[model samples]
Target: MSGKVFLAGAAGAVGAALTPLLVESGYEVYGTTRRLERMDAIRAAGARPVLVDIFDRERLANAIDCIAPMIVVHQLTDLPPGLDPTRMSDAVSRNARIRGEGTANLVSAALAAGCECVVAQSIAWAYAAGAKPYTESQPLDLGSEGARAVTVVGVAALERWVLGVNETGGVGTVLRYGNLYGPGTGRDTPQGASPLHVEAAAWAALLAVQHMKGGAFNVAEDEAEVTSEKAKREFGWLPDMRLPAQAAQ
Candidate 1:
């Protein structure tokens, strides 16, 4: 909880919720945003702001090297605001690229920086269609057509790269979060399948970074779509938690 922690995608919804948590937890937080305009927001959240694109391997590596963080958090995504239906197809493709290629770059950067652990964001709804409450061991829906197929493939690649890095000495933890709602995210209340608060999603990442044992964990409410018992037992995490009033703004 007291290391120099580097957070990728730190201007995104969950990232915005997480920055203050990391700072409050006494971590020397370095938050990243691709847009230079977001540096002030990151800084205001009590983190050192870094501007680096996840697609730019060299810049990301340099940023990580400069920060020398012990923990690296991957929250990168390219989805449009409110998940605009008209733009969803393009967003899916872009987001998949972020998951696949962006994840590769982040892993390489973390490894080069000698990071001890990496905590990454993933989705809970990617499981194959047979289960009620899917666990971490369930297979992803790899055979689906169109957008789902793209997402599943991208997710598989991201998980493989992250978990594989553990063999070389860096521990990897993946938090498969349910659909996020709450502040900064478009939804203020639960809406879709396995609805999760954005602050809860951020809390899961914080728990994963602090206490995970190098494997995937489902992070959701006590609903039937996904199970978060493992995260609760292992990290003592609770999904109902919210950020402070100031941070939520």
Candidate 2:
């Protein structure tokens, strides 16, 4: 099942973790990054670097069209280091825009390229107050206010756009990752409910791309806040899995 893969946000935490896995699995990867400085890092991970902002529809479309990958992976995000409380007000809006508009653009480019599958990053903590452990069937917290509302709305848009690819004969898989920690995430230890390591999140995306399954799955630790049974059973994902030291760099 190896073929070309277009990875968005290649310089990001999860993206950096996922790139080597894709290459080692025999997929030719083209990773996207907005910064010229990160190109070498993507190359080091064995993926060709593509410098294009997700908001630039023309360049994004052109890049994807030229690559014409079999799968598209979206690991894009916008958040402050350590999720500093002081900067969160503005960061929340920016992050929402990334999840909403950025995801929309990526999906559009993917569909235009006739990609077979699209694997996207989402969050596991967005579920509304409900049972202790939330599942993929659980509804998102759409009725929240202020920052929470903004985040939920953006998440909804992202999931909708990604899942809608199925209507056009393409597979769409969303991994609802829990609060991430570990290298490059600015946290060395787990924090918050359903804590997940960055490597595990990356592995989940790889599994989705390999399985080419459509629908959402919660990618998180075996905790009470969210249930990861779906992902474990469907994708054989291991929440504690970490990338090999050399690959993680």
Candidate 3:
């Protein structure tokens, strides 16, 4: 409970919400951001700020090596604020790259640093078309076309890299989060098929860090799109969970 934790994408929505939780739970957190302007925000959230791009393998590896955290959390993404419609095409491609290449670099660095566990972010809406509620065992929509295809492919790669690390004696937990809303996210109310509050998503990541179990879990509200029962039973997560007002600040 009192070890080092390296959080990638510490300036992000979920990262911002999860940082204080990690700190309060007794972890020494080192958080990464690509922009110098975001460094203070990370520090304000109770973590030491580390400026390193996820795509910069050498620099990222060096940063993780210096910290030698017991746990590494992957919450990186490349989406624009509010998910602007006009820029979605470009955002999707960039985000796909983040999920693909960025994840590879992070897992590699985590392994090199001898991390005991890694918890990564994924999406719940990528399940292949079929049933009303998809389970973790369901296949991703790998055969889809256009933007969705790009996303699914990237999700698959990220999941493979994250889960495959378990074979090396490290625990890998992937949380397939639903469409996130709430603070830091553009939407104040729920949005998308399986809407999830940003704080609840952050809470799930904290649970994953605490659980140290390897496998995927759908983290979302009770909805037809996906089932979050696994996370609820395993991690005691609740979709309604939210950070206290002070902690949120």
Winner on TM-score between 1 and 3 is 3
How do the residues 148-221 of candidate 3 rate in per-residue lDDT, one tens digit apiece? 99999999999999999899999999999999998778899888899999999999999999989899999999
Worst 10 residues of 3 by lDDT: 79-88
Task: Please report the candidate that would top TM-score against the real structure.
Answer: 3
Indicate whether candidate 2 or candidate 3 has the larger lDDT: 3
Tens-place lDDT per residue, model 2, 1-249, is 589999999999999999999999999999999999999999989999999999999999999999999999999987788778898899889879988999999999999988899989999989999987898998999999988999999999999999998889999998999999988888899988989999999999999999988999999988648999999999999988889888865
- Stretch of 10 with least lDDT, candidate 1: 183-192
Candidate 3: residue pairs that collide: none
- How are the candidates ranked when ordered by TM-score, highest leading? 3, 2, 1
TM-score of model 2 relative to the true fold? Answer: 0.98
RMSD (Å) per prediction: 1.1, 1.0, 0.8
Scored against the true structure, residue 59 in model 2 reaches a CA lDDT of 96
lDDT of 2: 0.92
RMSD of 3: 0.8
Evaluate all candidate structures by whole-model CA lDDT and list the values in order: 0.88, 0.92, 0.93
- TM-score of every model? 0.97, 0.98, 0.98
List where candidate 1 sits over 4 angstroms from the true fold. Answer: none
Candidate No. with top lDDT = 3
